[model samples]
Target: MLDTEAFRDRMATLPHDLSEYARVQTGPASWSAHPHAEELSAWALEDHVDPALVRTTALLVDISPTDVPHVAVPHADVAQLVSHREAFVVASINGEATLETMLDIVGLPSGELLAIICSLCARGIVALDRSHRLVTR
Candidate 1:
């Protein structure tokens, strides 16, 4: 299982607006890049599981039971961020967002992001090191 605390902590380091967007959008049924989302969705649909339950289950993919307080993103900063894609990109690269998170941050769809990430990983622009963290060389 993915480490929820670590995941949330990493996400917390993103700019405030992005973090809030992530938190508000997060729930059991919210979309996930996790490999399990499709299978879980299919099962829920086929079995007629309560949509709420399905959503809750989906939220479990990245949520931790332990509450970690999040730092607020100032409105002014968020406003500034709206016009600064370069800043966001730099921050993401510095923060080491996973290929999936990086794609979301850059507003690319999953397929395209996956392709780019795969290509970069292959070329060693981004690589998983001994700690399983993606790093740029």
Candidate 2:
């Protein structure tokens, strides 16, 4: 079941004015400076909320799912990750894959996978293309 209270609390913490953060490209298709990037990612790692729902909420809060960004690991070292699932997701990326393809390759529910991706993205470990870098997902 979805935890509405926790979800709302998380949402409340996210930045309302994303324009202030300014999308700065630290790596391939990454927006490292987004206000919600780090906070959201950290929440995903520790929060008890459903991963799939968190993924959906993340999209709604930052970018819409229809945007379907391409994702990739910017760095080679992902050994520091504590969660095996997160490490697996990082390993599964070869070059850049669509968010849909990543979901398939990682074999994790969308919520879990996306949360990991978001966390990596915040840490400059993964890059998510917000623009039309790859149209087909």
Question: Which one is best on TM-score?
Answer: 2
Q: C-alpha displacement of 10 in model 1, angstroms? A: 60
Against the hidden reference, what TM-scores do the models get? 0.27, 0.43
Instruction: Give one digit per residue, the lDDT tens place, for model 2 in 2-117.
Output: 99998987774554866535554333444355768888778757869876566545644664343344334334456754367767776676655667666666678888777776
Indicate the residue-level lDDT of 110 in model 2: 88
Flag clash pairs in model 1: 28-55, 28-59, 29-55
User: Candidate 1: TM-score?
Assistant: 0.27
Q: Rate the local accuracy (lDDT) of all candidates.
A: 0.45, 0.61
Give residue 18's error in model 1 in angstroms: 42
The weakest ten consecutive residues by lDDT in model 1 span 62-71
The TM-score, computed over Cα atoms with residue i paired to residue i, of candidate 2 is: 0.43
Top lDDT prediction, candidate number: 2
